[model samples]
Each structure stands twice: as structure tokens, then as C-alpha cells.
Target: MKRTLALATIVALSLSLGSCRKKNNEPIAPKPNPEKPAPTPGTNPTPGTNPTPTPTPIPAPPTPVNGDNNNTIKPDESPVNATVSIKLTKGARVTIKSDKPLTITGAKLTETQHTYEVTNESGFGIDGDPETLDLSIAQATEFALDKEMPSLKSLKITTEESLKKLSLQGAKNLEQLDIAGAIADEQTLDLSKHSKLRLLALGNRPDMIGKFTTNLGKEYPSINSSNPSTSTSFKEVSLPTSLEVLFLAKAYCALVGADNLPNLRAAYIYTPKAELLGDLSFAGSTNLDRLMLAYTSGGGALNSLTIKNKPHLRDLFLYQMTIKHTSIDGLPTNTLMYKTTNYHLPSIEVHNTPAVKILSLLQIATNLESADLTNNPDLTEEKLVKIAEKLTAVKGVNLKIEADKATDAVKDAFQKIGWTVNK
Candidate 1:
């Protein structure tokens, strides 16, 4: 009865006490380890952990992977900071990300004007995946090609300053590339990797090379004197098999594998100072249509001309050549035009062309050995008379023709030019 009364009294006292705590005697959570710094705001910290005994030192700046001047890029630096990067000598690198109109100043009208411009400009200002790209900055000394531009089919770059190096490894699908004044330091240009490249135009200005003084407060006649030798012209070129049209002005590179290309359609090469050493044999080029060669003011002469198997050749223009051989063999079945001027060959044999409409051999070194036009079915009576009047070198030379297809006037015109008409 006394224990029960005591329990009843304790319950009555606890019920009478307030719910709020008046005072607490429990030891405060042991003061957080004072030596340890507070956890970072977002980081979850272990309650009773120890700090690192020794602090780690910050690493020094990384060294450039290339040479002292940092000319070449590091492998880790493949990610470009911007869409395009341009760096001038001794200047901070600049970046361009805006889709501003980039102009090709001296672009050809016959090639790209119809597709790119209404006036005389070839500009690229598209928002995405532009087909053409022209980055022709005059002051850029180093061009970084870290970003891949896959949709670009045509590219033109012109730099007035010394372009130490250039690699088109970033442009994967280029078709036409024109870099006329971008004088490079490398002696050889290898384009064998560009499998889709079809048209190419490249040249260098000789007078604009080396040091030059500024004029009228502008960077006038910007020069590239990276190589000051007289033989600074390109020594070798590696052309791709897919090349169809080529234009090289002031290019002295040897035509090493140029004739082995089977898809070459047209080639316009002008070299003024170096002799093309190899025989310009186009026997392997079966699809060649037009070939224009002009070599002036050099000892450059054709050692030999071979067109043994070309079937689609149409136009042949040879200027200022000293062809060692007398005959240009294998005039294709579809030849439409053949003209040679300022040549030093003694004779030529043109035969077995049924599609020839124009033939001219002006300013040759000597008269022809014979003029054979026997199988040309396209030489109608009126066309025959016109062709006979233009063959001034046929004077005192025997001319063979299909007499049954020619009119009396066609025969009379050949006889008037001193040609011994042979039926």
C-alpha cells in the first residue's frame, strides 16, 4: 500500500510538470575538433576526422610541347578555345566565333561567283556547316586548325606575313583550295591525303618576298622572308589521284606523279624559272580533256610528250615549249582543239581524229613534215576550206585529206597555200 501510494505520487508530479525543459545538465556535444577546419559548404564532412598533415604545393605552369617559341601545338591542346584562332608574330592570339561574312577578295568569277555571290565577291556567312570558308587575314602569322570543319568543300587562305607551316588535316572534305599569296616555308606541299580535292590553285609572288618597308601608315607589301634563297620555290608536290583540275602559277615543283593520275581533266601550269625535268608523259591519264602548259623565261623545255592511250583528250595548248620530239603521238579520237605557239619542234603528225574542229600550229620553229587529215569525218567541205586557209606552214608540204568528202573550193584553197593536195 505504501509503494503504490509512492508511484501514484510520482505520476501525479510528472503530469503536473510542464512539457518545456527548464534546464539540461547533459555535456554539450564535445566541442568540434578545433584543429580541423570546417567542412566546405556543399561537402559532407566526417564528424571526427583529422586534417592532412602536410599541404600539397601548387604545380608550376606546363611547358609547351613544341619548341621554345611554341610554334607547334601540344597534343593535350587539341580542343580549340574558339571556332577559329589567329595569331600574329609577337602579338596575343585572337579568336573569332562570330558568323560574320568572310570574303574571298580575289576569287575567280568563273568558278565560285555563281554559287556564292551576286556581285564580285565570294563570301561565307552561313550560320552552320558552311560549304565554303575563306580566312584570308593579312597579319596572321600562325593559323590554328584544331577544329574539324567537315562540311567545307572549298577553302581559300591568303596570308601576307610569313606562314611558317600549314596542315589541312582539319578540313576533311575540301574540293577546291586557292592560296595564291600564302608563301610557305616548307618546300614540298603534300596533297595526297585529300581524296576529294578536285580543283586547286596555288602560287607565290616573287617580288613580294623578303623584307619590305611600310608605306602610307599601312602594312604595305607584306612579305615572307622565312627562306631567302633564290631557289625558294617549291621543289616537290604530291598530288592526289582524285585531282581533276589544277592551276599552279610560279610553281617550280617537279611533276613527279602528276602524269599517273587517271582522272585529271585539266591542268594549267606556268613556271618561269625552273626546268620541268621529267618527261611530261600523259599515257596513264585516260580521262584528261584539256592540258595547257606555258613555260616562259627559263630553260624549261619538254623532254618528251606522250599521249599514247588518252581517249577523252579534247584541247591541247602548248606555248613557249622546246619539245625535243617532233611528233605528239596518239591524238585522241575526240580531240576538238590543238594549238601550239612559239614551239621548237621540227615536225608534227596529227591523224585519226574524227571530232577535231580546230587545229593551229603558229610560230613553230620549222615547217611540218606532213599534214594528215585523212580520217577526220567532221571536216566538212566548208570546214575543210576554213582549215586549209589557216595552215600557212603547210606551204611546200604534202597534205593528205579525204578527197571524196571535199568540194572543189576546198581543194583550191589548199593548192593556193602551196600545199601539195594528196587524195
Candidate 2:
């Protein structure tokens, strides 16, 4: 009866304590281990009442993985060499979560006018294996050649994405753009909106390169195409009214119009076996000053045809061939030129022409200062003196005439050129 009474009293006390704790709400404390002396390693400690040591709670810095919560752009210049990481707007899903090891040689926030050109001017070859060119790999070539960096004036692209990248940068200062390889491809970038563009070279992609010169006579100006795959030629080229220079060098099998290039100031032609002298004459090229017709055959030249209105034709060259009469009829004064050796004296009929101020006959003209003219056996001192006096208008004097026999004054001049004068 006494043991039963003890158990009932303990149960009543436990119930009263629980009810008081629930109502008052005392805070719970973490359990702590009981202190004890160090025991030997081999001995097993008693089980039931054993305890774990308490660990120190430390604070940590905010991080992406941990939801500490901070969203702001950060510049990472050290992430890559000479490169900087900028904040990318969340338009597309950018996976820059650290796994893409980008060892950037360069990084910057840039728009269109700023360009990076990779040129091998020092004649260095790229080194590396082509099979390993998995763009994901650090940009390394299979073979490395010397780096020659020549400043590039312009660039061309057939890729729509690349074009878009360049377009996003800006086109205010772009001088020349070429997409000739993509003109026929619809996937090529559309560049017709670049109104300030002075030069455009396009291919036949038709979509990416777009139909720019279809009404070339009316719409897009200054467009050039030489794509053999898509058959792009001069058939669709429209010479802009503001054009100052037009180069048609290797378009022999491709160029279409012969005279439609109006207002061309400078032109380079290499048409072969073609008779274009009649139709090749400039119609609206009244302002034409420089015209190069190298390697273009079929007889008619500056002198053969009537260039009656080209008063400004200052520079003319008929090298590597015999130009028929009338090739130099209407040439401007002081015309710059070069031709085969004149074994016989040339007839410079335009002599005393007002515009004829400086005439160049020697290849190395700027170096020569005076000529030893007194040596020619056929021409005497009187004749040389006259020629010298006339040539006084020219920058340098040339009196180096060849002959076995020479006058005393001529021998003196020859001595000046290191020749031994006859005793």
C-alpha cells in the first residue's frame, strides 16, 4: 500500500509541472554535454547518458548558392586576361554560371564603331589541330604563325549573327561593308538600312545579303558583287551619284554595264580581249580624273578614241603596248604617264601647254638633280644647252645621252657620272 501511494504522488507532481510549463511558455535551451575527465583510448565509455560536444555557430558571407539575396551587376576583369565581364540583360538565357571557363584575351562593353581585326601580317601561321576546334576549347590554332597586326579599314560578313553583332555596335563610321558571299542566301543579314554606308560588297544569298541592287539604277547605290557561286555580277550594281572611286579590277567575266558608271572619278579596269573603247568612253564622267585600263586589249585607247570632253584627264599610262595615234589628243597638261623606252625621240606635242608644268621621264625621278648632257656625239653643246634651257622648267635635268663619240663639254659631263674623260 505504501509503494502504490508513492507512485500516485509522483504522477500527480509530473502532471502539475507539465501544465505550468505549457501555460507560462518558458524557452527551451539546447542540451549540453556533462564535464568528465579524459578517459584512456582503449576503454569503451558508458552508453545511455553520453553526450555530444557543442559546435560554435559562425556567420557566412552572402553567396549565389545560398539565398542571401543580392542582384546587381559586377565587373570581372580578372576572370579573363585583358578581358572584362559586363552585366548581360536577361533577355536570353545566359548560362554564365562559372562552368564555361572563359579565358578572355579581351573584354569590353562596346558598340558598332569599335572593331577587332585578327590579321596575320607578320606572316605567322596558326598552330593547333583542326579536329580539336570545338569552339568550347580555349581559342587556340593548330599551328601558330607570327602575329602581324595590320590595321584593317573595313570588314565583311556573310553570317547573320555576326552582322547583327556588328550592327548592334554601331555603323556611324563604317566606311566599307562586304557581304558578297551571302547576298544570295536569305539567312544573310539585312544591311539595306545603312544609309550612310559608302561601299557595299554583297553576294547572292538573296535573304541575308538581300536584294539591294535590283533597281540598282534607282535604289541602292555603290554596290559591288563578284560571287561566282550565285552569279552576282555588275548586272545589279548601281554607281552612287556621290561615288568618288570605283574599282572593277578582276570582274572580266562578271562585269555587265560598260558605260553606266556615271560620275566615277577614279576607275580601274582589267577587262580582257574586249572592244569597249566606243562604249567605254565616259558619258557622265565629266569629273573623271584618273582612269586605269591595264590589261584591257582590243586596240582603242585614250588616243584612238575621242575623249573630247575629258579636259581633266591628268594621268595617262599606255605601258606594255603601242598606242595608235590620237591616244593623247585631248590629254590635260602635265599628264602623269609611263611607256616603253623611247629609242626614237617622243613627240610631246602638248609642249608649252599651260598645264604642262612638271614632266617625268625617269623611273627614279625625285632623286636625280642634274644631268650631264654635254656628251652626245649626235647632239652638240649648242643643242644640249638649248634642251637644258628648255628643261629648266622641270625639277631635274637629264643629259645622259649614249654615244661612242662625244664633245669636250659632253665628256666633262660624263666625268661627273664617274666616266673617264678622254685625254
Candidate 3:
């Protein structure tokens, strides 16, 4: 009985030892790592490096002017739709009140950027008695102020299409006004009321041709007419008395009222397609400084040019044109430069112009041509020779000069260059 019990104990011990060996040889699972993150999908993982995260982008803020919360606009915000947009500058502001909600675009936010409402979808008007209103618009025809705008100082309107009509009444203090784009054939602005206007720039298009009328109903002669003589039928457009600087581009009109503008200092007209009809006279403009009439690409005839009583006239440029009659009486005393290229003047008098330093008379006409410089006491022999050298050496040119001014050298200089010098 004792031997059997000992054998059973030995068998149990062997079975326990076998079970312990089997448990030690089995495979074990590892704990998850905390330092390294898992690799992103479709990415090649390094030996033991963590992947970088992508950052999110922040949005931009709204545009602000001088930290004013009201005059702020986000970049992604939609633009306001407006028929007429006014861009105020130089501390000029106006508050426009309307019956309905109206959108006005192209107003740059400034310190004085006041909020404004359009009167209606079709028009605009001022709310209170604001002085100055500066604005520029495109793709519009007519934009007239509803009320006087009593102290209004300046105004500017630009359009993509031709401006058919414009009206701003009771703007007596308006100093400057600039209008661009094509003006209609019958468009007329009676600026005689704006007596305080100093600068006026009417930038008309090249192809537009219009007439000048004292009365709006009656039509005068066309500026591009074959006969450019002052007729009893021709009417004059009334200008302001305080107009100092005037710029007219592609303006084909019989502009006849320089006697009214006593303070006219400078006038520039560019009429590329029309002839300057009638006596192109500036009879009463005493303060005239510079006058430039450029018919750049046309053969327009200036019938008579009268710059009478102009003491301060310095520069005069008549490019690509024809002058019918010009005498020494028409020349300004203080005229420094007189240039007329591609010209067709039969005779010109530059006898007593002491301040005449630069005289460019290239491409003179071939019909009965003559230039008399005999009475020029200020022009010496040296000055005459220098003037002769500057002239374009066209053959068969006749030049009459003073006997004292025409020396052997001066005669040789003029004669060698195909000019007949008659002393």
C-alpha cells in the first residue's frame, strides 16, 4: 500500500513540472507605446520617428480706415452696387439721405468717410447742407443734384459711355470741375452761373463733333466747316469770369467767349478732327500764360488768331495746323517759345519779338511764302544766323531781313541752305 501511494505522488509532480515548462515557452503580447504615434495611411514610416501634423490657415480681417469700425469692409465681402459712385478726397464729405436703401460704390474709406445713401436707384441727392462733394462714376449718363448744394466746391464725373446731360444748379462756389468721356452732340452746360469756377477740364472724345450756342435752341455753324469766318449767325458760349485754367480735349466748338474770362491764365484745346473756325480770339484774357491748340492728326485751318492784350503770354504751340492770317500785332511781347510744325502759313511776322528765343516753323506752306524780319532791332546778326540755322532747309524759301542784320556770313548761311535772303 505504501509503495503505490509514493508512485502516485511522483506522477503528480511530473505532470506539474510539464505544465510549468509549457507556460514558459508560449509567446507574449507587448504593451502599446505612448511616445511615438502611429504612421498616417499611405505614408512611409521612418525607423522610429513621429509624423508631423498639418496646421490650419487663419482668415484675413476687414479693411479699416483710421480705426473706424463703420468704414470697414472684409476682403471676401461683396461690393455694393451703385449707379453713381462718389470718391471724396482732401477732407471732402457729404451725407446723402434717401427714401429707400441705396448702394454707393467706389468710396474710399477715409477719416471723414461719412455714410451716404442714394436718393433712388436712378439718381442721387444730398441730405443736409454739405459744402464739397467729389465723385467719379462709370457707365452712367445723367447725374444731377436734386438741390442747390450751396457751398459745393468741386465735382468730377467720368463715364464709360458718352454723357448725354448733366445739371448742377446753385453750386456758385464750385472751384474745379472735371468731366471725361464723350459729350453728346447737343450737350451744353450753362456754366455762366458758376462765376467762382477756377479750373474746368472737359475731356471730350475724338470722334464727337458739336456746335456752340449762346441759346440752347439755336444751332450755330459746324466747327469743321470749310469756311472758318466769324458770321453774324455764329453764337458764343458764355464762360465764367474767374476761369483761370481751361483744358478742352477733342472739343470741336466755336469757343468765342474769352472776353468774359478776364482771369484766364492757361487754355489748352485738342481738336483732332475739327477746324478752329472764326477768329480764334482771346481778346480780353490779359493774364494768359500758355496757349496750346493741337489739331494733332488733322489739317484744320485757323482763320484768324487774335491774342490781343496778352502781356504775360509765354508759350504758344499750334501743332499740325494751318494759319490763314497772323501779323506782328498778334505776337505776344513776352512770348518765349512759338512752335508750329506741319504748318501752312503763307506769311508770318516775327520782327519785334524780343523775348522770342525758340521759333520752330518747319513744313511751311509753298504758296507765296515770305517772312519779314527787317524791323527786329532786338535780333542781331548772330541771332539771325542762329534762327536761319534752326529752320528746316526747304528749297525756294524767301526771307527778308534788315540790312544791318544781314552780313556776308549771314547771307551765305541763308543762301547756302536754299533760302533767298532779301535785305
The candidate that achieves the highest lDDT relative to the unseen native structure:
3
Better of 1 and 3 by lDDT: 3
Each candidate's lDDT (Cα)? 0.48, 0.30, 0.49
Clashing pairs in 3: none
Model 3 agreement with the true structure over 36-55: per-residue lDDT tens digits: 34333332222222241221
Off by over 4 Å in 1: 1-87, 90-130, 139-147, 204-233, 338-340, 346-423
- What lDDT, from 0 to 1, does candidate 1 have? 0.48
The global Cα lDDT (0 to 1) of model 2 is 0.30
Winner by lDDT between candidate 2 and candidate 1: 1
lDDT of 3: 0.49
Alpha-carbon runs more than 4 Å astray in model 3? 1-127, 204-237, 274-277, 327-335, 338-346, 355-368, 372-375, 379-386, 398-416, 419-423
Worst 10 residues of 2 by lDDT: 129-138
RMSD to the hidden true structure, all candidates: 31.6, 35.3, 31.7
* TM of each candidate vs. truth: 0.49, 0.29, 0.55
